[model samples]
Target chain A: MTDRDTTPAIEFRGVVKRFGDNTVLDGLDFTVAKGDRVTLIGPSGSGKTTILRLLMTLEESNGGLILIDGEPYTHEMRGGKRVAVPEKRRRQVRRRVGMVFQQFNLFPNMSVLENIIEAPVHVLGLSTAQAVVRAEELLEQVGLADKRDARCTQLSGGQQQRVAIARALAMDPEILLLDEVTSALDPEIVADVLGVLREVAETTDITMLIVTHEMQFARDVSNRVLMFDHGRIIEEAEPEVIFTAPREERTQQFLSAVLGEDTADRS
Target chain B: MSDNLQTLGDALPRLGDAVLVTLQLTLGGAALAFVLALLLGFGSRSHRGAVRVPSRVVVEFFRGTSLIVQMFWLFYVLPVFGFRLESLACGVLALGLNYGAYGAEVVRGSINSVPAGQWEASTALNLGHVHRLRRVIFPQAWALMIPMFTNLLIQLLKGSALATYILLHDLNYFTEQLRRSTQDTFFSFTFGLLVYFAIAYLLTLVMNALEVRAKNRLGAGPTLREVLRIAPVPATAKAGAA
Candidate 1:
C-alpha cells in the first residue's frame, strides 16, 4: 500500500481491555482511514462500544497502543521506548476526538447552545462570541437551530441527541466517535438524529467510528462494516457484503438476533 | 399580677439588649459554620492524606464532643494555652466550628447527590480540576445543597441558644434574666421561644423559595409532591366524570 493509503485516522493494534477478571476487548485490531465512515455491529457485550470509547480516550486499554492520526493516544515512545504520556498531553490529544453517547449526555444544567459551546470556549480557548457563532452553525447543521436556546431538559430525546452531535461537531474534531446515538430515542425520534449523522457523513471530512444496532442505517451510511463477537471482530467487509452475506456464524447469529428472527414473536 | 406586670416592664429593656447579642452570635456563627463546612466537605474528598486526614480529624473531634464542652474548652482550656478569646468571640467560634462539623455532612451528601456523570463529562471535556469544580460541579452542588444547608443553618440558630451558659447575653440569657427580675417566668421564656420559632420559620420559607428557583433554573425534575398532587387530581377528576 502507498504511504497515503497506509495511514489511518484511527488504528488499534492488539488492544486488550479487562475489568478485573473479565476481558471485554481481547487483542482487538482495527483501522479506520481518514474520513472513512465505519459502523460496528455486535451482540450486547461484544466490545463494539469499547473500541469506540478507546479511540475517544474515555477508557484506557490494558494492553496495546491506540493511534490517532499516526500518534499514540495513551502513551508516547521516546527513542523506541514506551512511556505513558503526561496527563496534560493526553488531554490535548483528546480535544481532537469527540464522542456522542448513547444516553445523549448533554449537560442538563446548560441550555443546548451552552452545551455546544462549552468545550470550544474553555478547552479550545475560543472567545465566547466566536464559540457562539460556531455553535449556531453546528446547531443549524444538526437541525437543532430552533432549539439552540432551549434547555436540554426541554428537548425530546432525539432533539437532545442531535444537540449532542452538534456539540461534538463544534469541537471540529478530526475523528468523531458515535456510540449508538439513536438507541435511546423513541422509534419516531430516531430518524431525526440519524438524518443529521447522515448529513455529517456526506458533508464533512471527519472520520467516524460508529457502534450501532440499526443495521439498515449502518449498511447505508458506512463505507465499511465490522462484526464483533466475544471481544473480537469476527468479520469485516464492505457494507453491502456485511449486510448481505457475512462470513462468520457469529456475525450471522448477531444480525439475526437484532433483526428479531431468532426469537418468538412476543409482541 | 399587676405588680408582676410592672416588674416585667422594667426587665423588658434589659432583655432587648440581650436579644441583640443573641442575633449577633447566631448570625455570625451560622455564616462561619457554612463557610467552614464547605471547606471541610471538599477537603475530605482530597486524594492526599495530608488534606483529607486532618479535615476528617477536625470533623470527628468536634462532632464527637458535646457543643457545651467545646464552648467551655474554648473559653477555659484554650486560655491556659494562650488562646484567650472574649466571651462573645468564643461563643461564636465554638458554635461555628461545632455546627460546622454537622454542616459538613450535609455539604458532602449534597455534593454526592450531583450525578457522577457530570464529573465524567467535565473530565471528558478536558476541563482542569479547579475549573471543573467551579464551573460545572459547584453550581449544581449549590442548587442540590440549599435545602439541606438551610436545615443546618436553622439548627445552628437553635444551637446558638446554648451560648447563654458562656455569659454571652443572647435571647435565652435575656429570657432567663427577664424571668428572674419580673417574676413572669412563663411569659418571658415563652416569648423567647416564639422569637426563635419566628427566625427559624422565616429561614425555611426563604430556603423553600430558593429550592423552587434553583430547580427551575437547573432543570432538576419536579418535586415528588408536585408530581403526586398533579397526578392524582387529573386521574380522580377523569374517574368522577366517567
Candidate 2:
C-alpha cells in the first residue's frame, strides 16, 4: 500500500457491547490514524476502558465491527455476509495490537526481562538473543534497565508499570492501547509512570489510544480528545477546544469536577 | 506363644514383596489419574451443554462412588460382561478412575485460578490453544496443582492397600495371612499400620520437596547461561565500512 493510501491503524464503527441488560458501549465510532496520539477521558462506568478493550479484541463487540489496518478484527465479510472468523485468524490480527493494563498485568511468574521478551520470543519467533537485546533497549527507554533481572513481584507499582509498557512495546505493535495504566499506582509513582508514557508519545511512531483520568496529561499529550459518558463520545474536539471551550453541558460538568481537584490542591 | 511369634516373624520377608506390589499399583494409578484429570478439566471448558454436561456427569459419577464398590465392580461384574481384566489391572483401573474424578476438580479449579488477563494476554500474542496452555497456562497451573495432586496421591496410596481384597497380595494381604496363621493380631496389624504410615509420610515429604523446587525454578530469574546467551553482539564499524 502507498503511504498516502495507508489505512488508519485502528477504527471502530458503531461498536456496541452489553453485559446482560447493561449496555456499556452504545454504537461507539472513532478512528486513529497511523502515528497519531489520542486520549479518551471519562468518569467511572463511562466505557473508556471498554473501548480500548474492544479494540484489543479482549472483549467482543455485541454489534458493529472493529477494524485494524482497515480489516475487520472480530469478523470477516464472506460473500457479502459477516461471518465470525476463526480464533486463529483473530489471533493473527491481535498480534498487531498491544495493551498496557491499569492493574499492570505482568506475568507474576516471569521476571521483568522475561515479561518484556515473552511475546517477542514466543509469538514473534525472534531469537532469544535478539529479543533480549531489544528488551534491554526498551527497558533503558522506560528507565528500568537496572530492574530487568528483577522478579515482577519485587518491583514497586510504578516500576512494574514501566516494565509493562516496555513489554507492550517489545512486540513492536502498530497500535498501543493504554487503559488507565497509572490509575492503580500511588500518587507519587503516578508521575513517574506518566512521565515514561509522555516520553513514549514524543519518541515512538506507534499510534496510542489512551484511556486516562489525568485530564492535564490528556490535554497535553492528545492530538484529539473524546469525552465519554455512558458509552457514546458525547463531545469530541481538539484538546485546546475541549479543555477551554467544550460545547456540551456534560463535558463542562466532567471537566469542572476534574479541574476543581487541581484548584483545591493549589489553594 | 514362642512358636506363634516365630511364625509371624517368618512372614516378614513376604511383606516386602507385597509392599512393592502396593507401590507399583499406587504409582501407576496416580500417573493415569493425573493424565485423565487434565483431559477432563480441559473438556469441561467447552461452552456447549452437550460436551460439558456429559463430562460433568462422568466426573461426578466416578467421584460419587466408593473405591471399594468400584473395585469389586471391575473385578467381578466387568468380567461377567466379558471384560476380563487381571486382578492387579482391575485394582489399578478402579483406583485411577475413582481418584481421577477427584483430581479433575482440582485441575479445573487451578486452571480457572489463572487470571482472565493471562488468557487475553496470550491471545494478544497470537498463541493458539495448545501453545497457550503448554507455554503459559499449564506451567502456572502445574505449580498450583502439585499440592492438591500430592494429597490425591496419598489417598491413592491408601486405596492400593485395598487391592488385597481382590487377591493382589499387597501389604494388607500378607498382613492378613500373618494374622490368621499366628493369631498375633496385635503385632501383625500394628506392623502393617506402621508400614502404611511410613510410606505415606515419605511420599508426602518427597512431593513437598518437589513443590518447593518447582516454585523456586519458576520464580528463579534467568540462569547465568541464559543471561550470557542473551548478551548482544557489538556493532562493528569495520564490517559496516567494508
Candidate 3:
C-alpha cells in the first residue's frame, strides 16, 4: 500500500467487542475506502449489527481503536497505552455517521417530518425552516411526501422505515449504516424500502456499511461484500464475485444455506 | 328531620370554606410531588452513585414510613427542633414527599418501558443526553405515566383528608364538627364521603382528558373532540320519529 494523504472512510483495527461471556467481535481488522459501499452478510449473532452499532457510537467496543475519517473516535494511544477518548470528542466523531435500525425506530412521539428534522434542527443547528425544507425533499425522495405530517406510529412498517432512512439522510452524514432496514417490513413493502435505498446508493457518494439479508439488495447496492462467521470475516470480495464464485468453503456453505432457504420460501 | 336539615344548611358555609382548603392542599401537594417525582425518578437512574444512592434512600424512606406519621412529625416534632411550619404547609409537605416517592417509581418504570431501540436511535442521531431524554424518551414516557399518575393523584387526594388531624381545618375537620353539633354521625360522614367522591370523580375526568391528549400525540388514542362527538341517529330512529 502506498502512503496517501487521503484517509479511509472507516477503519477498525484489532477491534474486540464482548457481551458478558459472549465474545462478539474478535481481533477484527478492515478498512472501507472513502465513498465505498460495503455489505456484511452473516448468520444471526455473527456480529454484523455490532459493527454498525459501534460505528454509530451506540455501542462501545470492549477493546479497539475505531477510526472515522482516519481520526480515532473510540480510543487513542497515549503514553504507550490505549486511552478512551473524551465523550466530547466521541460525540464530534459520531456526528459524521447515522444509522437506520431494523425496527424502524422513528420517534413515535414525533410526526414523520419532526423525526426527519429533529437531529438536523437540534444537533446540526439548522434553522427549523431550513431543516423542514431539507426534510421535505428527503421525504419526497423516499416517496413519503404526503405522509410527512403523520405521526410515526400511524405509518406502516415500510413507511416508518422509509422515514427512518430519510431521518438518517437529513443529517447529511458522511457515512450511513443500515442494519436490516427492510427486515421488519411485510414482503409486499420490502421492495419499496429497498427501492429508496437503491436510489440513495446510486445518487449519493455517502459511504455505506450495511448488514442486510436481502441478497439482491446487497448485490445491487454494495461495491464490496464481506461474509462474517463466528466474529470473523471469512471472505471479502466484489458483490458479484462473492455471490457467483465465493472462494472460501465457509462463505460457499453459508451462501448455499441462505440461498436454499430463500428458494424454499419462494417455492 | 327539619332540625337536621336546618343544622346542615347552617354548616354549609363553614364546610365550603374547609372544602377550599382541602382543594388547595391536594393541588399543591400534587404539583410539588410531580416535580419531586421527576427529579428523583431521573436521579435514581443516574450513572453515578452520588445521585442514585441519595435518590434511592429518599424514595425508600418516604415509601416505607407511614404518611400520617410523617405529617405529625412535620407538624409536631419539627417545632421542637427549631423548625416551625404552619399546619397547611406541614400537611402539603408530608403529602408531597410521601406520594412523590411512589410517583417516582411510576416515572422510572414508564421511562424504562420506552423501547431500547428508541435510545439507540437518539444516540445514533448524536443527540446529547439531555436532548435525548427531553425530546425522545420523556414524551413517550409521559403518555405511559399519566394513567399511573392519575391513580397516584386520587390517592393523594384521599390522603389529604389526613390533614384534619393536624388542625388544618380541611373538609374532614368540618365534617367532624358537623357530626358533634348535629348529633347525626351517619349523615355527616355520608356528606363528607359524597364530597370526596365528587372531587375524585372530577379529577378522573381531568386525568382521562389528559391521557387522551397524550395518547393522541402518539397517534394511539382518539382526540377528546372525536371521543365526545355525538353519533348520528340510526335510520330506524329517524323512521320512528317520522
Candidate 4:
C-alpha cells in the first residue's frame, strides 16, 4: 500500500497492436485509477477486449509503454525507446493481476477445487493445506462451496464461471480483468454470474477493467464508463453521464444499437 | 506328436533365453523411444529455428528411411568407419529411433490437441513454461497419448523381429530353430505366431489398465479396479464403505 501511493493502477501510452498490416490499437492512451470500476463499451472490433488482454500480458503491444501500479509493466524506456521487459519480469508483475475469460476457460482435466488451488500450490508455493483452506474460502464467496469436488465438465456454464471467479480471486490480484465474462452464458444463467460479479465489486476494493455487453450490469458496477471507437477513447464519464448523455455521435450510435433505444438522431 | 514334443523339449532352454532377449530389446527400445519422442516432440514445437528445424528434420529422416537399412548402417556400415557397436546395441538403437519418430508425431499431436484456452489459463496462473507443461498441459496430453503409445509399444514388439536380422538372436531366431530341427514348418511357425500374439495380448492389457487409470483421473471412464479387479470389491460400491 505504501509503495503504491498516488500511482495509477494502470497507464497506457501510445500503445500499438497490429495484426499484419492492419493496426488494432493505434497508439492508444489511457489511465485507470486504483480501485476504480471502469467499463469499456464499444462496437465489435473496437479493441476494447484487446486492452484487457494486453494488461494481462497475454498480448504484446507492438509499440509504447504500459505501467502497472506505477511500475513499468509490458515495457520500459531505454534510451527513449520502448523495450519489452523480460518474460520473467512480466510473469512476476502479472502475479498481481488476474483475468476471467468469456469462455470461463476452466481446466476440464481438473476438479473445481483443483482449478482454484493449482496456482497457489505450485506457482505461489503455498502448502496444499494452506491453498485448500484459501480455496474453500473463495468457493464460499462465489456461493459454490459444495461444488468444489465436482468436475468442471459436469458443472453448468454459470457454475463454472463462478468457479473461475473463485480461481482468479484465489490469487488475490490487485486488479481484475473481466473479458465479457457473462457473454457466453445462457440468458438466465447470466444473472447468476452477474450476481457473483456484483457481490465481488461491492465487497472488494480491487480495480476492475470490464469489457461487457450487459449495459445494465455495466451501469450497476462501474464507476466510470469509457466508450471506444476505432482503438481510441471517444468519450468517457461517470456511468450515469456516459450512458445517458454521451457527447460523441459514435458513442450514441453504439449505445442505441446495443441498448435498442431511440436515443440517437441519425439525421 | 512325438517329434513335436521332442522339438519342444529340445528348444525350451534356447527359447527361454530368446524370450529374455526379446523382452530386453522391447523394454529398452521402448524406453529410449519414449525419451526421444518427448524431446523431439517439444523440440519440433520450439519457437527457435535452431531447435525446431533440426527436430523436424530428424523425425523425417528416421521415419523416411527403412528400419532395416538403419540397423545395417549402425551394425555393418559403421564398422568400416571404425565405429563398431554390438549387434544388440545396434538393434536397440535402430528400433528406438524408428518407432520414436512415429511416436514423436503422436506426442506433437497430443500436445497441440490441448486447447489454446488451457495454455492461456495456465499462463494466467503465473506458471512457468516447465511447470505449466508438467502440471497442467502434460497430464491432459498424457491421457490422449496413452492409446497411441499403446499402439506404438505393440508395433515395436513386432518390429523387434527385424532387430534379430542384425546378428542378435531373439524370439524369431529360436522360433526358426524349432522349424529347421522339427521339419514341421506348420507347427513351428504357428508356435511363433501364438507366442507373439500372447505377448501382444499381455501388452494390450497393461495399456488398457493405463487408459482406465488416466480416464478415471479425469472422471470420464471406468475405474482401474473395475478393469483389473485386483480385489473382490463390489464394482459400484466405494472402497471401505461396504
Q: Kindly provide the TM-score of model 2 when superposed on the true structure, using C-alpha atoms.
A: 0.90
> What shift in Å separates residue B90 of candidate 4 from its native position after superposition?
2.0
Query: Can you tell me which runs of candidate 4 are displaced by over 4 Å?
Result: A1-4, A261-267, B79-84, B228-242
Of candidates 3 and 1, the better by TM-score: 3
Tens-digit lDDT string for candidate 3 (A1-267): 344436899999999999999999998999999889999998889999999988887788988789998899989889889999998999999999989999988898898899989999999999999999999999999999998888777677888889999999999989999998887778888888999999999999999999988888899889999999998999999999999999999898889988877763310
Tens-place lDDT digits, model 4, residues B91-119: 88998999899889999999999988888
- Cα deviation at A127, candidate 4, in Å, is 2.7
Error of 1 at A200 (Å): 0.8
Better of 1 and 2 by lDDT: 2
Backbone collisions counted per model:
0, 0, 0, 0
Q: Which residue pairs does candidate 2 place in steric collision?
A: none
Candidate numbers, best DockQ first, in rank order: 3, 4, 1, 2
TM-score of chain B of each: 0.85, 0.85, 0.93, 0.93
Candidate 2 chain B lDDT trough over 10 residues, lowest sum? B233-242
Most accurate candidate by DockQ: 3
The collision pairs in model 4 are: none
Per-residue CA lDDT of model 2 for A33-81, tens digit only, reads 8888899887889998888888777887888778888878897668887
- DockQ of every model listed? 0.31, 0.23, 0.47, 0.37
Q: What is the lDDT of candidate 4?
A: 0.88
Identify the candidate with maximal lDDT: 3
Decreasing TM-score order of the candidates: 3, 4, 2, 1
Candidate 2's DockQ? 0.23
